[model samples]
Target: MPPPPRRRGSSRGKILDLIRTTGPISRVELAEMTGLTQATISTSVRELLRDGLVSETGRGESTGGKPRTSLEINPAARLGIGLHIGRDYTTYIVADLAGTVVGRLRVAGVGDSEPESAITRMAEDIEQLLDGLDVDRGAIVGVGIATPGPLDRDAGAIMGAPALGAWTGFPLAATLSEATGFTCTFDNDATAAAIGEFWLGATGGYNTYASVYMGAGIGVGIVIDGTIYHGKQANVGELGHITVDAMGPTCACGNVGCVELYAGPQAVIDAAHEAVEHGELDMEFTGRITADFDRIADLALNGDATASAIFARSAEYLAAGIVSMVNLIDVQLVVLAGSAFQTIGSLYARTIAQRLGERAFARAVQTVDVRMSVNGTDAAALGAATLVLQDRLSPRSLASITLA
Candidate 1:
């Protein structure tokens, strides 16, 4: 037996989110954790079960009474599409409600290409990916796009980001939605990665953390008390633009000695080229940042002193920026994510941890937990997909209030 369909409310979303994040929970536990009455929990659970968003797993231990049924999210109930538009490549992934990547695709980036054509091509790529999956397209609630930041979230547009040339002021969300026939939403890549981590239960019991994402540039995503910290204009984490050296080269963002200029993928590529010119490293430049950076990373891994030094220097600079971020945010956990960290994630994690232990302002009070993303390089894309699920299933709100 199921309850009749009632008007959707914020309570239902919160209940569903709890099941997704901390599932196999009994109705009594839900009521206890949410501070909602048994009747309210029952009503919400019934609605969730009727909507096929949750399922009764099995009977739980009896507490001197009838066995309680545990509830969990139905991963197959709905799906979401996530796209990470990078300067070198675009990653597309389809995720279930559990934040699991069921399918994925990678395609050429939108380098100097017309935004309209690039977006249309990306839509086609998404169609190609969906066609290969054995799932109903209607089950997909929407698409979430993660790209370089300075985004106008309300307008669903990408501002004039340096790495994303020719995509300035483009109504990406609306256009992609029209092209793909699904509602689309957009956010900063770093923010999306952080949200994805949170949605996937990567933070464990910790409610506050920061996601440090490195792609073509460096960025940070802050999650405070289980919610993303989207400052004014939804562009809060521009860690790359933060000045690390007062006299270093100026960045496209007009900040001198910005961390990104020294630690981002482009910085690695530029440093590798310099090493090649100096006849120090014997690797041919591919002119493509991804390809060239891969070579440098390989050389560094293979004990090339100059190559390793380039990466080490970059890590040091990035560490300084992260130290500043941790000091300001006062978060305990920091997650390293993005394509740029794929080959050398552990190195960055180790370096950042060491630096934070020595330099963080709160070192005396608490040590910052530095680790790599569970989603690996696909974090941003997977996070983008989770954004769709979060938007449709877990609308953000303050603490859940007790139901009358």
Candidate 2:
């Protein structure tokens, strides 16, 4: 068997990162940006060019004398794969060095299947995707997996994700790595979303922010001091399970009146179904009412009294949850994200903003900024891909820190 690849940091890696982030620059500019000497930058660029990872794109216009050669990262030199493991489906995307997705594959409903079987299928799907693309295998750096929490990051296993029953204690990262022969990394879906927003969305400059991910369940990803806080055991941000009403409804986590029980998509659909069943409305909703929730939002937006009441109640619970979070963390910004938030996000944003203004303990000091996630359907997946990028480029050791 082939020996494991050597793991060593090199000047070429840092140079590649700099070029990928800010390219079309001269070696002198790179030296200035990286604090490396001009001779070192030229040496690293030569190695990168030899490896086909970078190239001299063109000559920069001369400022004083002869035009300097502009160095740029070869977008085709490397690829990163991002996989978002949702409750119902997995989304796979191949992104270039520039963070642009050039190829994609969607795998639907593998959550109910056995873990090994699902992983095997996922591996096959990835192979198929790679087979179809013209990208070189050597250029593929690694894969990133975004799964629902709570997860054991050290073990790379899913603990007890309700949406993915077959994934309990599954060694997802190792399985993918063994199957594909590539380095693999794992992160919580919500945290991945926040990183995605920072890396590719509008939250780059925001220091303290919260990414409220509303999917099969609600999860909040906190960014304090420009870094994601993954508290003890990678299970810190369980915003969905935050208690909103002591006597409300029972949640899947065996808690009563959790925020998710009131504001999650399932809860909204259940309310609508109950309303329909009790002759209060005439909309039939049986299984997985994603579309039905949108129908309720439309009705509320269109001035239907009953639907408006239901949405308002849900929004109230959502606001209460956000207010509680704000009082605890005092973050300046909150970004609403997830597939469910795509349609009715404005209603949630308005409710959360108003409640934060009125009731948060920090209201006297500062106002919490609530906004929608800039990346719509692809936030989680894109964030997952960014895990690979961060693992490779970012200075901090995300794996070593214990979140609060």
Identify the candidate with maximal lDDT: 1
Q: In model 2, which residue pairs have backbone atoms overlapping below 3 Å? A: 231-403
Which candidate gets the maximum TM-score versus the true structure? 1
Q: On a 0 to 1 TM-score scale, where does candidate 2 land against the true structure? A: 0.84
* lDDT per residue as tens, model 1, 257-358: 999888888899889888889899898877778778888999999999999999999999999999999999899899999877889887889999999999
Q: Model 2, 1-404: lDDT tens per residue? A: 98444344455666776676677888888888778888888888888799777789899889998899998878777778888887566788887777778788876747467888888888888899889998888878788888778899888998888787678887899998998888898888888888777765466456788898887788988888755787656687889899988888787788888998888888888888788888886665536545577778788788877788888888899889888988898798999888778887888899999999999997898878888988776778877776786575433456432111
TM-scores, all candidates, are 0.94, 0.84
lDDT at residue 373 of model 2 (Cα atoms): 88
Candidate 1 lowest-lDDT run of ten: 395-404
* lDDT at residue 2 of model 2 (Cα atoms): 86
